[model samples]
Target: MTELFDADPQAAIAAYGTEAISDPLDMLSRLTAAAAHTMEAMGKRVNDIEAIRYENKQGGEQIRGEVKLYMQAMAQTGKFLDMLIKSGFEERKIKLDEQTAGMFVTAMQRVCARLELTPEQTVLVGTVVPEVLRGLEA
Candidate 1:
């Protein structure tokens, strides 16, 4: 492990470029942009899901199926987000992988608890989380 030091660190940092920082500002900017896009997509998906749920909430087989799909999608999205954070930390040599993952998981759990979702919305979120993660990793 490279020991952290203060004196004349520019040479050492230049050796690793931007990746050496705890949180590269440029990387964070890109991640933030991707996250914004994901949030927009998620909003649209939620709207569609709400429409479907409203249209077919008569306690039928389809409703059960949709609910199951929705839950699965949500879980998958959560996992992808975890992957994103993991990759980001790995790339940056951040030491708090566990803490970062926990923060993301906790945030997702809180969001899920607050929002009622449908299958479409869940799937969309799943897709978006991975995309955002990829952006961050890059």
Candidate 2:
């Protein structure tokens, strides 16, 4: 995973092109791509936390607490990204389609699995994603 850092607006705008900004589908594609990248990055972070525990046995308890905090942060961030993507579609008057939702759910599921979410966490995601998607569809 690329090192997490602040994105340069000029670089993004230039990479996306001025013409793409006016296109809602193109915008959605960009948002989806970003969401996927975040998920992958979160998974890598979770793996990194595990590696840290193995490398620093003296700080196992503190590392575990940090791991829990990281998991919660990632979960919330994932949900926010999900909502942001849905809102982007709704704001653009684009109907949420099965393929788009499926791809998003799959990506999120992978992240949740990587983070080893609790049953309640899993259920919250299972419930919320569909509700948001359904609202977008309606």
Candidate 3:
């Protein structure tokens, strides 16, 4: 890059018959222009790399979320998620009262038995069920 910048100004000055132009000033101008171009290129490359990383990260998170959902469906925890939503927790961000919470536990226990899920299987399903139905909307 230095060699290119060093050669260009000399060639330009000779071609334009501008030796009368101060050699130092002309070279300085070319060097500054080359540095600006290099910085612009470097900035673009940095942006491209950042964009790729962001895209890859988003895709990875999405795939992981989907895989967890698949595991939940296999375990029948998808129904639990639906039951939770249908308990009138879908739109309003309201906390469940103690009575409602008890009912929920009872319902969950019934669902577990109905599905023939062992304690370990119930725990495994509880860990992976999608909190919200993101996949369904898609």
Best by TM-score: 1
Which sections of candidate 2 miss by over 4 Å?
A: 1-17, 50-138
| lDDT score for candidate 2 against the true structure | 0.66
lDDT of 1 at 86: 64
For residues 23-114, write the lDDT of model 2, one tens digit per residue: 65665566656656666676667776645354355654344544665566667667656766776755554454666767887899899999
Q: Rank the candidates by lDDT, best first.
A: 2, 1, 3
Please report, in order, the local distance difference test score of every candidate based on alpha carbons: 0.62, 0.66, 0.54
TM for every model, in the order presented, reads 0.29, 0.29, 0.23
lDDT of 3 at 113: 86
| Model 3: per-residue Cα lDDT over 48-134, one tens digit each | 442322225445523233344334443444444444456554343334356676786788778888999977999876665544335
In model 1, pairs of residues that clash are: none
The candidate with the higher TM-score, 1 or 2, is 1
TM-score, cand. 1:
0.29
**Candidate 3 TM-score, C-alpha based:** 0.23
Using lDDT as the measure, the top candidate is 2
Model 3 regions lying over 4 Å from their true place: 1-96, 129-138
Name the Cα RMSD for model 3: 29.5
